[model samples]
Target chain A: MLKEVTAATFENEVLQSDKPVLVDFNADWCGPCQMLKPTLDKLAEELDNVKVVSVNIDNEDEIAYKYNVSSIPCLVMFEGGAEVRRSVGLKPRPELIKFING
Target chain B: MYDIIIIGAGPAGMTAAIYARRASKSVLVLEALTYGGQIINTPDIENYPVAAHISGFEFATKVYEQAEALGAEFVFEKAVGITDSGTCKKVKTTENEYECKAVIIATGSANRKLGIEGEDGLVGRGVSYCATCDGAFYRGKTVAVAGGGNTALEDALYLADLAEKVYIVHRRDSFRGDETTVNTLKQRSNVEFVYNSNVTKLIADKRLTAIEVTDKLTGETREIPVDGLFVAIGRVPENRGFAQLITLDDAGYISAGEDCLTNVPGIFAAGDGRTKDVRQLVTAASDGAVAATAAVRFVASLE
Candidate 1:
């Protein structure tokens, strides 16, 4: 299951996580963001080493600002609290898996 | 190996799959993003034959269902590269590689972005390309659309119903859209036309607040306060991934004739990805049908 994280719990839930966290910075109004939800859900179920978390840019503006999330459906891969890789727009399931694994 | 591998799931790709399946060929469609391509962003589609007045989402869904029910297997995967094998073609995606006897390129296009300042920074905040997806968020607020084509006119008309005020800012004085659609948008009381102007800058700190538009005739600059800015300028072909495999035009569209046959044998291009005069729904469907038929003929020759 994809975990929905807020600005308050982001530090502990994502930054201090043991596994690499794939953070999806998104909003309800964004069409591509909504489209990426099913892919993220599938990733969350398939991957055990990575944690998939969703951050609503509208609700967690501070987190979005901190991460420099300019676009919706922006996927930021965080390892040891540092952003390792980032991609924007909607990607397919295989691409998302490759991004998380890499 | 599969008989055919289609590299998109839009109207063109799906239609191609439908035709290929009817030909008794094992077909696979790989879509990088969501299906429906650019049409999904459109709220209403009246031009498509038989569907007099239908929502784009509903139309796309019905077509997808039809293709799926016809035994066209679909995989959500972005094709990274294509290699020319002796008898078959190798399609390398982000996940796995698939060898197919024939390949159909129908990856469609994406909305072109205004490369002005603050435009990239305000994508989700206030800047949007799909009015149908983002129009409801700006309800009761003011918004501006940039372009002169049918998309810009349609966006203005769509936003006018939701936004308090909708401004159609085009670089040219005259719109290039249909006269009927232009007249319909003009009749809307909430719609305003800002002709002969260009959006030079987007003013925003964290989120978008206003846009700087410069008048072409007068050279006078003015700021329009808007809650959201919908960009419907145009589209760019999504053919970057297949550039190494096939010949593309200067504008990045695959150089294919009416037959949708690319420079490479056993490979075909279709839909908006190919060089064409008209890029409409009907034209794309026609290309799909033609391309699939050509692919079937190519596969039979290999046998």
Candidate 2:
């Protein structure tokens, strides 16, 4: 099941995960965000060892602002509550896994 | 070892090379064709900020020279595939193979063709695709635009400023374009919206003379006398080579992270090939810079 994450639960769902958590911060109005969703979901299913969650930045502006997310559909990967990798805009799963493993 | 290997020598790839080289990373750019990508085919580019009006070749030359001056090394080769074998990624070309710590894919998109008769034959002579680049050429001339989408409508509106008459031809009676564009075109005396019509053939011997448009409803064929024909149907991402290595959307565009990272680690895609809402050159360049920076950090992490 795809876990829906908000700013309120971002800390609990992603920041505290034992495995590397990939957060897809997105919004509905963003066209690129919509295009990147299916890929992210597939990646989450394929890479079960890595925790994948999504956060709607539109619903949670504070978290987006805290992360300095000026653009929607930003991906921030956290390991042990620290941001190990962060990227903005649309990206492929191979590159995301590279960041996680690099 | 090079920090990033950027594929395609387009605006995005060049801009990424500039940034990546500036960031103290050794950058290698691989190009299948000549540098500049699709922008080379454009006749004139006006929207590129500083330059008011410049030919496509001139603008591309400036970028090419700038990237070269910045210590970026360019290699001419066609990239076939990439393999991520846990140690280092291997980029395969027809002639040779290259290994790099990280990769940045800046391959741009290609315009979708209408596939009508004479469309391919009269490509440069009297037929054109990009309005921003080809509009000024038809100053006070008559031109016909095919398709009713936003890109087509926008091209019609832009052509209205330069052409004596602009015809907006569509297959359907109703257009999917915005209300503002439709309203503006309707208000313009020079612009005419031709509904339920499709171009059966582009008629031109040496140059574009006219187009054979057939009324879909009435089944009547009529020839519209025009000097130029601009096709603004749509575009398709040219991501065939790496589709198997990375995830692609239904439209064959690379699925990228917000930062332009692909499904594989240390391999990122940017610009028109990657799924983006906007495919403008400025946005493509921005994506390139972002992907390069991310690649830099990723390469650093390899150690």
Candidate 3:
């Protein structure tokens, strides 16, 4: 499981974080999001350069809307309080790692 | 080194793991993502014999657990390439490479997309390929599904209960899916069928607002206001990485027969990635059994 972030803590937890954060924009009903949970957990446990967190679109529609997140399991990498890259759908681990590292 | 290395953890690959492990050959299944492949997005599976009325996720979990209980090691890694050395084969991945006596390539297919303008850009905003995964976001909104296959029909049917209205657009007059399912859709009050048409353009600003559909017979076009567009056209096999090592058809599917034998010896292809007429869950399982059995024989002959 990933650290859940809401509209209240989005700034300090993600934008102002010291290290790069991989934010997973997801929802409870999205099957792909649930399917990606284990992989995200693995990444959280293994990787050191980045922190993995998730925001449920259902609870924080404002944040989801602000980021133009229309898809579930959307991965956005944040650095220096700015969005660096975003991947829309479920992808292979190597590709996800590349999206975060590259 | 292992006796068999299976690329992919979909039904075919997992089933191959089960069979190979049962035969007492050390087995390993490498999956790029989680297990279940495209089947995970499925809501319910009714067509598979004996296992009636089970969700796709449950079925996948059952198979995965069975393989794991049978002592098949699973590694979540993306396989990049394969090297065949007659008796010993190497499976290269994004993380590590492992040696195996035989290999089974069962990487399944992915959802096909409609290459219209704004289609790729608006994914999640209003355009979605998977209804089961993304349909909940469009509750009480008007949506359109494009395709005449079972997948499209099923997506439209599934969305009819949630969305305010559903428009099922197909290029052909008749559907290639089961007639019973078509009739079921006909009985729905919120479902409408648009035949002989194709979705040519997506009308959007920040999100999807409508779609431009063209009549194939008349060349006339109409823009339909829809909150979402669900594309269930079909699927294309994921075999680009192995096109150089093995044989692939024009559509990029591994060239293989029902026996699952690839062009290279001691390496086999199974599941939706392989070139075959049928690509059902049962057939993929059958291919796994056949491929594993053949792989066991090949390894035995080498010894």
Best by DockQ: 3
How much is the lDDT of residue B170 in candidate 3? 95
Pairs with steric clashes in candidate 3? none
Q: RMSD to the native, candidate 2?
A: 22.4
Task: Tell me each candidate's TM-score.
Answer: 0.76, 0.65, 0.83
Give the alpha carbon lDDT tens digit for every residue of B19-122 in model 2: 88988888889887567777654556778788888766566678889999999999878788888875488888777888888988888887788898767656
Docking class of 1: incorrect
TM-score of 2: 0.65
Tens digits of lDDT, candidate 1, B1-303: 899999999999999999999999999999877777766645568999997887665677788899999999998778888999767799999889999999999999888999987776578678988787667667788999999899888788888888999999999988768899899988889888998999999988657889999999999999999878999999899888889879999999999999999999989999999999999988999999999999999999989
User: Once superposed on the true structure, which residue ranges of model 3 sit more than 4 Å away at CA?
Assistant: A5-23, A42-52, A57-69, A76-85, A92-94, A97-102, B44-55, B58-62, B65-71, B83-85, B94-98, B187-189, B249-251, B276-278
TM-score of chain B of each: 0.89, 0.83, 0.90
* Per-residue lDDT over B199-303 for candidate 3, one digit per residue giving the tens place of the 0 to 100 score: 999999878888999999999999999989999899988888888889999988998999899999999999999888888989999999999999999888888
All candidates: DockQ = 0.22, 0.01, 0.43
In angstroms, how far off is A6's CA in candidate 2? 69
List candidate 2 stretches off by more than 4 Å. Answer: A1-102, B38-63, B136-141, B176-178, B214-222
